[model samples]
Each structure stands twice: as structure tokens, then as C-alpha cells.
Target: MKFTKFTGLLFVFMAIPFLTFAQDWHVGAFLGISNYSGDLTEQRVDLKYTRPALGLLVRKDINRYLSIRGAFTWGIVAAADSTNSSKALVARNLSFRSNVFEGSLIGEFNFMDLDEKGFTPYVFVGVAGFGFDPMARDQSGNWIRLRPLGTEGQALPQYPTRQPYDLFSFSFPFGAGLKAILSDKWTLGFEIGLRPTTTDYLDDVSTNYVDQNTLLAYRGQKSVDMAYRGDEVTGKLTPGTYPADGTKRGSPDHKDWYAFSGFTITYRLGASSGWGKVKSARCPVLRP
Candidate 1:
């Protein structure tokens, strides 16, 4: 009986945030571009590979300055070493394209109350779970998935410490935006958010190269062919032209990151009870 009483109190304690039944509710869509930064990008984000992204979001305003938002986004991210300015990197000839789908729950804070000011700058921080499948075009111009091949020697007998990376990972999403009230029922916003991930294999090029012969023997010819491609560019290249086995193919110290930037438009369902201003028995007012 005592335990049950304690549990009931704990439930109510946890339910304080959701007591926001008296707040405002909003639903919206995000349309924008997405890009990635990794071994293939020399900078933080490579613009050349930017691709269209789309998302749907629902928000609940806990109060005038704070809100909770949930969103689902889909986008494309890709890059190629061939686009590098350095001949050595270009000859390395690594490339990958991946479709990323992310779902996030975030807390948003407005610097100024949009309800009173009509416009405000906002910031948000969130946690997201995202999935991506990296692919590269084969010599035949067909796209091939990269994971099962274990291009980095994952799951091979010789390197027991090298484990396969999961296709899905958790990311930290944080960014800022500007919001303006368009009307009583609508709002317009622009936001840029970045998701830094835990995995280094988003491009499937992290760590050193596996022995080409061993990779060829265990994972088959496709694995060896995709693992190293220096020969493909320079005809009749010397055997050692490929990064010799156990050499750096990518920096394991650095992880990959992807980002989304776009415009958001939201519609207000209705103001929660007691959230609106008391009219003081005054006349009609403009859309608040």
C-alpha cells in the first residue's frame, strides 16, 4: 500500500510538463537542404553535395517562451574524394551517397515572446535517432551498399577489435532560428540544425585498409574492388598505388556529421484555456 502511494506521486511529478494542456499546439512542415561533413568533406559541410530534405513537425508550447517539438525528417547526403582539389585525394577516389531519416524531440526557447512581440529569435536542442545506408556506384555505374562488404576489415578474423557499425545511430541536434507571427493562426520561421553522430562510417571510409587479398578472399571480389580504387582512375597503376594494407584510409579520430536547414510554417490549432489575455470586458482586438 505504501509503495502504490509512492508510485502515484512519482507519476504526477513526471506529469508536470504534460500539464501543458493549457498551452498552444502547432503543426508544421520543414522544407530545406541537407549536407554532410566527413572524410570526403574538407570543411565542416560540403555544399556541392547539398540535397533536398523534407520534414513534418508538431509543437506544443509549454508557455510563452518554451515549447516541445517532435519532428521526422528525410534527406540525402553524399560526397566524393574525386571532388577534392588535391590530386592525391582525388586519386584515392572514394565516394558515397546515403539517405538519412531522422526523428527528433527537442526543447525550443524563444528569446522574446512571439505572442507579445510578433517576432523573436529562437534556439533549440534535441536528441535524435537516425538511420542511414551508405552506397557507392560500382564500375558498372550501379549503386551498391557498403556495409555488408566490410570495407574497413570489420568482422574479419585477423582484426577482432574491428566491429561492424550499426546503420542507425543517436545524434545530438542543436541550432537556432528566427520566428515571426504571420497571423493569429499562423507563424513563419527559418531554422538551421546540425546533427553530430557517433559513427565514423557514414561514408564507410574510416580507419585503415584491409589486406586486399584477404578482403578479396573473404568478402569476395566486390569487396576488394570497392575497398580500394586507385587503379580505376590511373590506368595500369602500380600495384602499391593503393594505400598499402594497414595504411590510413581515413582518420578514425574524427566522426561524421549531417545537417538540415530550412523554412518552417506552423498553424495554431487553438489557444489553451486561460492562456489568452483577459479582455477586461474591452472591445475587439487584432489577431493576437
Candidate 2:
């Protein structure tokens, strides 16, 4: 009997902390422009363009002054045509594109503590983990890889002619925004954010191209006759022969990585209106 009572007491104590967290769990989604920054913007003529983002977020206001928030955003950033002159092109004319999958944790300090306040200005700082795939694809949809002659008969139908640049990095994220309560249960808000990453190759630097304005072959497909042979008599497709994929060490042309930014509009969920409330009996208060 004593053991049973002790176990019951332990369960109740553990449940208390979970109940506290349940009070602050709210679901929300945001729409906004997502763009890039850092080495990725070295040749981009315009720093700002509109992109849309949607994500689910969960936030817990530990107290009026401090809170923890987490979110996942699906977004993209792209830049093209950095150079006007084709002959003088130091940068490739290909589009430097990045699809960003992001997850972040933010700490917010709300100035106004009231839940009904129409506008609350807050400052936030957090770390974001971004999974980005940056690549350039030409019109024919074939990745560009330089290979030796005659080997075309033996090469894989898909030999990754143009390889993907996978950029995974830790970034410092910061922003300021206003949240307005449109009604009892709904809040509409917007935020502008900046993120700084540690990569210098975002613009595809370390190559003959200074920017991304010259690799325009990606704009459309043309079947141009080129020679690729891998045989002395009939060469075995040995690595490092011709039409090399940019990944080769000591290659003059290689892919680069970059950082980005975003603007977002978010909708908040709570007992206020969008969803029906739970039965009163399901929620029992602890009376001491």
C-alpha cells in the first residue's frame, strides 16, 4: 500500500511540470520574403526580392520578460545575371539558387506584459540550423560534367554532370517585430530577420568567375556537339579526364555557399477563437 501511494505521488509531481508547459504551447504559421546574404551576395545586383515562407512554431513565455520560441521555415533565395557584359564576365551567368530548410530557437523579451496588448515590440536572438542545397541547372535539365571522349557509351545515364552544392551551417539569427492581437484568439504579426553564416563561397567564388552572371547556359538548352572519349583504343572512363564536374580539386571552377534573410507574417493559435475549447471537466484545477 505504501509503495502504491509513493508511486502515485511521484506521477502527480511529474505531471505538474507538463501542465505548466501546456499553458504556453501555441501553434502558428508565418508568410514572408526569404532572401540571401554573406558571400552568396557578392555579385547579386539587388539585395532584396520577395519570397514566401510558411512554418509551424511553438512558443512558451516563461515569464513576462523572457520566453523560448522554436520554428521551422521552408524558404528560398536566388540571384542571377550579375554581369551585363558577356565577354568581361568574371562571374558565371548561371543562377545561384538555394532552397533553405531552417530550424531555429529564439529568446524573446516582450516589452508589454499584457496578453491583450495590440502591439508588442520585442527583440530576439537565436541560432538557426539551415540545410541548403545550392545548384545551377541548365535548360536541358542535365547536370554539366566534363568527361573524356568515347566513354559516352559507357557513362551512367546520370553521372551528375553538374553536382549539387550542399551547404549545412550554423548561423546567428536576430530580428525585431510587432505582434498585434487582431481578436481575442488571433494575432497577426510581421518580422524582418538577418542571419550571418560562416561560409565565403556562397557566390561560387574561388573560380575564374567573380560572380554568377556568365553561366547563362542554364537559361536554355542547345545540343552543341562536343567530344568526349575515354579510350586509348577505347579508354576506360577514368576520373579527371574531360568536362570535369566542378568538384575536382585544383579545378578553376567550383561551387560556392552563401547566407540569407527573411520577412514573415505569422498567425497565432489559442483558446481565443479559431478552434473550439475543451470541456471544463477535462481540465481539473489543483486545489490546495
Candidate 3:
């Protein structure tokens, strides 16, 4: 299915509970850094490519130690093999940048009473769905979407194993954070969350290079040109130098991963109203 339609359904599913629960809620915004790990990243979790990320979240407290949250986040993730010091990677010279949009529903478990006046560490785990479009710059520096180019012989009858990847996929998100009560109605938090995704094409580089001649015949010269980007760094294309069909282009054993680390400031909804008072009385130890 298209990513937009899937996301719309996810929002509707999460929103239903909010309308029915009528519980204590907190609305917050976060600013942080995001990064990716995959074949193009040379297996290094480098901070050099970290990009700005922002998110909005709504949390409904189930008690002083547990809560449910729904969040939507936007971030940029990128990496380049050209920047690697390894000779093999520098020669590969592949790179990509993608904008990621993620929606998640998570359960948070606080190690201590969250309503207390001090700080507590918490862990969260949930299901997330995200959409990404990986892109790379052409010789002329124009950004070109890589998926449609069939860089790895995707969607071709000859390469049945190299099927096209979907732009939207599911993931498992789990992370830990610390939160502190700043006032009666405000809380400050810092967290780092990791997403282990189901797809390996987050960087648009996975599996082996296709037979150049066949790729050219089926997908056009642009596919053959992008299938192996080594020429981009060498400045000269060597005829018949492409990796043979079925030769390794990227590791297929491992999937991609992305992470976000940031700070959040939240406003406790209905903190001064009768509902708030009743909630505070029911959980007296949680009063901030």
C-alpha cells in the first residue's frame, strides 16, 4: 500500500483511544539528532552525518509508573561511502540521503514514580511504521530518486531475488530516557530511541550488482550507470569493470537501523482543573 494511506490509518487507530479514555494527558515536543546505520554507512555509527530531528507526542498516563504515547517524528538520515577511509568503501563511492517520517505507538515503563518531584529513568517499546525515499546526487549534482532507477536490478524478471522494496515499512522501537519534573505542570526529558527496521533498502544499497548488459537492456543506461557508482569517485569509467552478476554489492544478512537522541519539554494537560485534582488525589505520591 502507499505510505500516505497506511499512515492515515495508523493515526486513526491511535486517536480512538484518546477520545474514549479521558485520562491525564501530556503534550510535548522534542528536538534532537538522527542518524542511520546500513550498508553505505560502513557499519560505523558516526555522528558526522547526524541531522536535525523534531517530533510531536501525546502521552496518556495509566498510573505513576506507566503510560502510553503516540508520536510522529521527522528526521533526515544520510551516509556516503566516499567519506570512508577503507580502501574498498572509498572505491565503492555510494551515498544516499533520505527524509524519514515515522509514526509510533509505545508503552513507557518508569523505573520510579513519575509523579514524584525529582527524576526517573524510563524505558519504552513499541511498534512503528515509517516512510522514506532515498536519493542520491547525479553527476551534475541534481538529486535523483534511487528507487525508480532499479539500481540493484529490482523488479526485473532476471533478478527474482532482488524485488523492489516498499517505501513504508514496520519497525520495533525501544529506548530509555530520564524525565524530571520542572514544575507542577511541566516536565523535562532526554531520551535516545533506536528503530530496527524490517527493510534493508533504507540507504537504497543492498544485494549484488546486476549484469550490466542485461540491466541496460531492461532498465536503461541510467540503471547501469547508477548500479555501480565507483566511477563517481574515480572520475573515469573503466569498460567491463563492473562487478559480475551475483557479486556482492551490499550485505544482505543485516537490515538497516536509525536512531534519535533529544530533549523534550511537556505540558501537563488539565493540571489545574478538577480532573487534575481528582487524579492527583487518587495517586497522591505522583503529585509534582
Candidate 4:
């Protein structure tokens, strides 16, 4: 699905639950850094490509130890094989950057009572859906969208086995956090979460390199050129030299992963009353 359509659906999903249950809500915003691990990154988490991330979240408390949250996050993730220490990766010279839009529904489990919290550590796990469009810079310095170009010969008759990847995919978000209640109405926290995605093409460099001639015929010359970018680094375009068909372009054995790490500040909404009192009153008294 298109990213815009997916985003619209996410907003609607977030709105419905909030409208239905108006009490025990905590609205917050977070600021952090984001990164990804994939083919280009080769399992190493690098800080050089870390980019700023921000998000807005809404939480509904089920109890002092349990709560559910919906959040919308935006971030940038990028990596380059050229930056790797491995000679093979440096010679491959592949790279891509993508902006990520994600919506997550997570359940948080606090280790201690959150109602009268000074500080409590928590863990969370949930499902998330995100959209991305990976882009690479061409020789002319123009950023080219990789999906339409089919750099790996995807969706072409010649390579019927290689299907095009979805622009939007699902992921599992799991992580831990620490929160400190600043007042009855305010809280501060820090969290680090990892999202393991089902898609391998987050960096647009997965699977084998297709025959350049086949890609040129099926996906055009742009596919042929982008499919094998080693020449960009070598500066020598040897005729008929390309990654042979069936050669590994990426390790298909593993999937991509992205992460968000940072701090959050939340404001409590609606004063506790009646049944809400029983829920909020379970905590030990706060010490001065």
C-alpha cells in the first residue's frame, strides 16, 4: 500500500480507541535517535548513520503494572557498505537511505507500582507496521528510488522467483524502559526499543544480482546500472563484468531490524475518581 494511505489508516485506528475510552490516558512526546541493521550494515550497529527520531504516544492504563500504548514515530535510517571495514563490502559499494513512518500498539509491564512511582523500570512488546522507500544516489547525484528500479531483478519474468517487496510491512517491537513520576500529573522516562521486521529489503540490497542483460531487457538500463554499482568505486567498467547470476548480493538468511532510543515526557489526563480511585490507590505512599 502507499505510505500516505497507510498513514491515514493508522490515524483512524489511533483515534477510535481514544474516543471510546477517554479516562486513564497519558499523552506524551519523545525524542531520540534511530538506526537499522541490514545487508548494508552487516549486523553491526553503527552510530555514524544514527538520525534524529521523534514520536507522539497515547497510553491507557489497565492497572498500575500494565498499560497499552499507541504511538506514531518518524525517523531516518541509512547505511553504506562502503563504510564497512570488509574489503568485499567496500568493493560492493552499495548504500541507501530511507525515511520511516511507523505506528505501534504496545503493552507495557512495569516492574513496580507506577501509581506512586519515584522510578520504575518497565518492558514492552507489541506489533508495529511501518512504511519506507529506500533511495540511492546515482552517478549524476540524483537520488533514485530503488523499488521501482528493481535493482535485484524483482518482479521480472526472467526472475520469476524474486518477487517485489512490500513498501509497508509488519514488525515486532520489544524493549525496556525506565520511568520516574515527577508529580501527580507528570512523568519522565527513557526507553530503547528494537523492531524486527519481516522484510529484508529495508536497505534495498537483498538476494542475488540478476543478469545485467536480462535486467536491461526487462527492467531497463537503470536496473542494469544500479544492480551492480561496484564500478562506481573501482572506476573501471570492464566489459561484460557484472555479478554473475545467482551470486549473492545479500545474505537472505536474516531480516532487517531498526531501533529507537530516547527519552519521553508524559502528562496525565482526567483526575482519578471512583473505580479509577481503586486502580490508582494501589500504590505505596510516596516518600518525601
Candidate 5:
């Protein structure tokens, strides 16, 4: 009897937190710009490559200072070596564009209560999964998918370790934002979030250049054409020869990263009137 009584008490104690929390939900839309960082970019965040981004998000504020958010975002990121100021990079002449879709779950921490301060600064960190396919324009101005061509010898038997990278990857998304309570029912905010990913192929550039002869023999002429683009600027590397096997094409030491910066507008639900405080059994506490 005593053990059963103890279990009952323990359950009540565990339930107290849920019972006291004022369930507040915020559904919102995010409008933003997306940018890419990788071997192709001259700077960590190349503004020249910025593109449009859009997302929908839902948030639940557990308390005055804490919340949970889930978001789905779509964006495009691109970069070109031709934009680089360095003559060597310009001559390399490689560029790519990737349309990406991401979904994330994050925990947010607010510095001040929006109900009282009217405005607050917040930060969040979360895990996200994103999908992307890199493509580049050919000499004919048609976009060609890069993965299937195995631009780095990914499809060749000689380079067994070089396999085609997956289209999906996991990332760590973390950033900060500022929020203002526009009304009891609406809130406005702006945020900048960065996602560092597990894969390095966001731009389809990594590791060394493959043997031109081998790549042509196995993957054909198009593969050779895309792999050694210096021909476009330098007029081909001595005809039958090219940047040979093991020539430096890209740095493999680091993975790729992307960022989203933009504005958000949210509508409150599930009792927006009882925003920051714990609830009572007899009455729902209203924000003043």
C-alpha cells in the first residue's frame, strides 16, 4: 500500500510542471535570404551569392524565457569562382547552384519577457535535415546536374573511396533574433541562423582533380569538360593533358555551411492572453 501511494505522489509531482505551464503556441512565416559558404566562395559568407529563402514555423513558449520551435525552410544558394578577385580562382572558373529544403526543431531562450518588456532578444540551437542537388551551367547555358557526372572521379573504380555524396545531410542550426510584441495576437521578429552541415559537397567541389584520361574513358567527354574548366579561360591544358591525378581542386579539410537571415511574423494561439506565467486550476492568468 505504501509503495502504491508513493508511486501516485511521484506521478503528481511529475505532472505539476505540465499542469502549471501556460500552453502558448505561435505559428509564423519566415521571409529571408540564404547564402552559401564553401570552397567556391571567396569569403565565408559571400553576399554576391545571396538568394531568396522562405519558411513556415511553429513555436510553443513553455515559459517567459524558454520556447520550442519547429520550422521548414526552402532556399537557394550559389557561388562562382569567376567572382573571386584572385586571378588563380578566376581562371579556375567553376560555379554551382543548389536548391535546398530544410526542416528543424530548435530550443529558444529569450532574454526578457515579451509581455512585460514589449521586446526581447532571443537565441536558438537545433538539429536540422536538409536536401539539396547541385547543378552548374554548361558552355551551352543549360544547367547540368553535377553528381551523376562524378566530377571528382566518384564513379570511377580506381578511386574507390570517392563515392557520390548523398543528397540529404544533417546540420546544426544556431542563431539569434530580436522580437517585438506587436499585439496580444501578433509578434514580429527578425533572425539570422547558420547551418553547418555534415557533407562538403554542397557546391559539388571537394578533393583533388581526377586523371583526365581516366575520367573521360569511364564517364565520357562531358565529365572531362566539367572537371577541368580551366579550358574556358586558359584555352585547355596542353591539349591531351590536364590537371593530372592528385592535382588540388578543392580543400577537403572543412565542410560546407549555409545561412538564413530574415523577418518573421507570428500569430499566437492556445491562449495568447495567458502568455508568460504559470496557470492556476481555478483561473487562467491573463497578461496585463
Candidate 6:
């Protein structure tokens, strides 16, 4: 009971800031492109393409040099075969549209103190947690079916042949942005960012499979060869043939990272740092 209580308290402390940010959030919508650069790129996948992301920021200014900010963002991410000719790659393309949700705690640093500033420039760094889901489409435009990779080791009821929810994963976040003082109370800005994760399959390109009959049979040379076929570099396969041994199961072997940037418009509230309304310098001499 003591352990349970302690754990509950810890979770509450972590959630307090997130709850506060939701109430007085600074909402903004901006569009920018994102792409992947790790293993998925080497496996003939299109991981880099035009994508857009949107986010909201909730900030608390601590002082001239530091402050805290929380944010939430969602977007589409993909990668392409950069080595292949654009025309050829498009003809034989395999792409997944993965959705991601991320939350971050950022620290702001002012290079020029508020008192010495004409234009204040700042930098930030932070950690974040994320959730991602990858989906693929067939020639008919319907999503293709999938099962978790390596689930063969589990029992039938415990391991589904095809389940949609298996593709989600968590990640670590880091990024930097710049802010400029437009007025005593208003600021403008832009930012670039990145998130790294331990999961190798964000595109469902990893793992292999065997056809239903061969898989259930669980024996013989034919099924063995079919299952291992996914190991081939070319990934060549006949549509109706028994599943190859190398038939991929999960997301591809690639690093997941995206780049995004946009302008920020901010309105400050309070009297600190000349943010309040300027009073008239010429007040008539008080009562005679």
C-alpha cells in the first residue's frame, strides 16, 4: 500500500504541469514538411516526403534567462527511396502514413538579457514522450492487414495473426527554436525539432511470414523456403505464392526523425519587463 501511494504521488507531480498547460494554452496552426533518415531509408522505403505538423505551446516565464514551456504536436511522417530514380520509385512504391502525438517540456535561454535587448534571441532544449501508429494501403486503396512480428513464439489466443494496434511505440524528444522581441509585450519566433526512438519498425517493414496453410502446417521444405524468402535483398515475390520466410512483419528498419518550423506570435501578460501599458509622462500638476 505504501508503494502504491508513493507511485500515485509521483504520477500526480508529473501530471500537474500538463494539466495547467491545457487550460491556458497558446494555440497556433502551422504547416511544415517532415521525413525519416535512418534504417528505413536503406531498405528501399520512402521515408522522406512532404508532411505537415500542428502544435500548441503553454509557457511560464521564470526570468530573463530561463522559463518552462509545454507543447503537443501531431503529424504525418514518411520516407522515400532516394537512391532510385523518382519515376521508377513511384511506379513500385511502398509507403506508410504514420500518425504521431508528442508532448515536451522545454527550457528557454535568452542570449541577450531583457534589459540589454534591441532584439532578444533565445534557444531551447527539452525531453518529450510520443505515441505512433503506422498504416499501409493496398492497390484497391484499402489498408493491408498485418500481424505483430515475432508473435509466433506465443500461443494462438495470446498472439493474433493480424492486429492493428501492434504498431504503436514511444520515443525521446529534443529540439531548438528562436524568439525575437517585437515589442515590450509581443514576440515573434521560429523553431526546428527532432525525436529519436529505440523501435526499429515505424513503417511495418520489418519481420517475415508464411502463408496460412504453410504456417499452420508448421513443417516441410516448401513452407521453410517460403518463410525465409523475406530475407532477400530484392524482396521479389509472386502474389499468390506461399509466404516467404523473409516476409516482413513490423515497421521497417529505420530511424524515425522529422524536421518542422514555423513563425510564432506571442502576447505577454503582466507588468514585468515593461510589458504593461505606458502611462502618460505629463500629468497635470496635482490639485492646487
C-alpha RMSD values across all candidates: 5.9, 12.4, 7.7, 7.8, 7.3, 9.5
lDDT (tens digit, per residue) of candidate 1 on 113-140: 7877778999999999999999999999
Each prediction's whole-model lDDT (CA): 0.88, 0.50, 0.85, 0.86, 0.88, 0.53
What local lDDT score does residue 11 receive in model 3, on the 0 to 100 scale? 96
Mark the regions of model 4 whose C-alpha exceeds 4 Å error after superposition. 1-23, 234-240, 272-288
lDDT of 1 at 62: 82
Q: Between 4 and 5, whose lDDT is larger?
A: 5
Tell me how far candidate 2 lies from the true structure as C-alpha RMSD in angstroms: 12.4
Q: Give lDDT tens digits, candidate 5, residues 133-220.
A: 9999899999999999999999579999998899999999999999998877889999999999999999999999988889989999
Encode model 3's per-residue lDDT on 165-217: one tens digit a residue: 99999889999999987766778999999999999999998788888999988
lDDT (Cα) of model 2? 0.50
TM-score of each prediction: 0.85, 0.58, 0.84, 0.84, 0.85, 0.60
- Stronger candidate by TM-score (2 vs 5): 5
lDDT of 6 by residue, 45-112 (tens): 24336577777776776666776777777776765332435433332244555776777777777776
Pairs in steric clash, model 3: none
Residue 175 in model 3: shift from native, Å?
Answer: 1.2
Candidate 2 segments exceeding 4 Å error: 1-15, 38-49, 82-91, 114-116, 139-166, 206-288
Once model 5 is optimally superposed onto the true structure by TM-score, how far is the C-alpha of residue 101 displaced, in angstroms? 0.4
Q: Per-residue alpha-carbon lDDT of model 4 for 1-288, expressed as tens digits?
A: 699999999999998876666557989998999999989875656787999999999998898799899999999999987788787887888889999999999999999987654679999999999999999998899999999999888888887888889999988999999998777778899999999999999999778888878888878887777777788785343333587888889989899999998998988876632332545657888999
